[model samples]
Target: MTQQKAVLRSDGFTFKQFFVAHDRCAMKVGTDGVLLGAWAPVADAKRVLDIGTGSGLIALMLAQRTGESVAVDAVELDEQAAVQAQENAAASPWASRISVYRDDIRHWTQRCEHRYSLIVSNPPYFTPGSDCATPARASARSTTDLTHDMLLNCAESLITEDGYFCVVLPTTAGDRLLTLALQHGWHLRFRTDIADNDRRPPNRVLLALSPHPGEEFLDRMTIRGPDQRYSEAHCSLTRDFYLFR
Candidate 1:
């Protein structure tokens, strides 16, 4: 039998419907972005916003999940990453539905007149003084630039009355965000605690909040089962976008 070899590259990631080239991005493709993209509620979303759209992964995913009538606007602060996101969106099947803007979310909110039905972000959660390997990574990880309060305020300004604001964060940061959101008059609609394995406590949390109050929905998910394989829940949740699911 003839033998063949496959070469792997680190510059980009391939999803089921689109490719995200992140070589220029400080934060490369990661589970948090994918989870938020796949897990965020998108039904009947006429317009969607993706904050801090590095590599444009979530924006592209939202474009794929949404119908022709839906429009997705993505904002990124980093110049190189914004260009990369734009290129990725242009290459995707839903190019017309996605718009990439190289601007801070804070400024974008001021200029944007239209309200979005849904807004999502895999935001920087690391506190200042957190150890990081690079300045770019530090900017992408640390909250020194984008505080939770600022994020919530921006969402409040841009979201429709009944719109949903969703984010994925570390458990501790997520808990703080919950409190902050409530203080800002936003009500929690859904929460999902995420863990690496069945035996460990959840290390991450997915939160969906809105201005309108509703009965809170809570759930838990583990990325890996006891067998050390991808859990069924994880697979099922990401099956639509993950190439291997």
Candidate 2:
């Protein structure tokens, strides 16, 4: 299959089953969010949580992948982004299965009694002092508002005994999360190093962690091949959700 290059639209991103309108979101639809949405372990996830669900992209993706029995909750802190997320989910085919909450995950977790079987986040990984174009973008990208420690603690409190907490982060930041997860008694279940091309060192990593210890799976994925086309492995992983794959 010839892979059609994906264009990043300012208004929204159109997937195979739904459209994500991200005009009001600080963070627009990007490869990291899409990658985490499509690749996270969702086989038996009865209840899923998407933290910082800008435009509700990952939540909607999970809703599309899971059975009708599943329910997905999306939490966002930013008002505009949260509203956009809610609108996006409401417009999707899986509207009934997805719920959008406009609150900080830490606050939401305190009031919520539900435990999730699967939780995924394309979290704020940039260093706190890094400069961004806008305050909203800064909040979305940097750890000042939602630090790694806070995220791990929130996930730890909300996850069931056998639940999986997955995230996509830049390789350096991912390593920090890995260390923190281990320190917090979470075990690594899977890891995927991703690079723009095989010749380049990985710039991003997909990590799946669990409360129970298990054999860890590690692999590498290159988004583009030598000819600069989408690699077969990347295409295979995302084929279900990408319209032009």
**Which candidate tops lDDT?**
2
Q: Which stretches of candidate 1 lie over 4 Å from their true place?
A: 1-8
lDDT agreement with native, every candidate: 0.91, 0.93
Residues 1-245, model 1: lDDT tens digits: 10000111488887778788999999988889989999999986989999999999999988888899999999999899999999999999999889999998998889999999999999999999899998888998999889999999999999998999999999999999999999999999999999999789999999999999989999999998897778899999888877645
> 105, model 1: CA deviation in Å?
1.3
Candidate 2's residue-wise lDDT over 1-245, tens digit each?
Answer: 33333544558877888889999999988889989998999987989999999999999999989999999999999999999999999899999999999998998999998999999999999888899999999999999999999999999999999999999999999999999999999999999999999899999999999999999999999999999888999999889888777
Which runs of model 2 end up more than 4 angstroms from their true locations? 1-8
Tell me how far candidate 2 lies from the true structure as C-alpha RMSD in angstroms: 1.6
Instruction: Indicate the residue-level lDDT of 205 in model 1.
Output: 98
Q: Identify the candidate with maximal TM-score.
A: 2
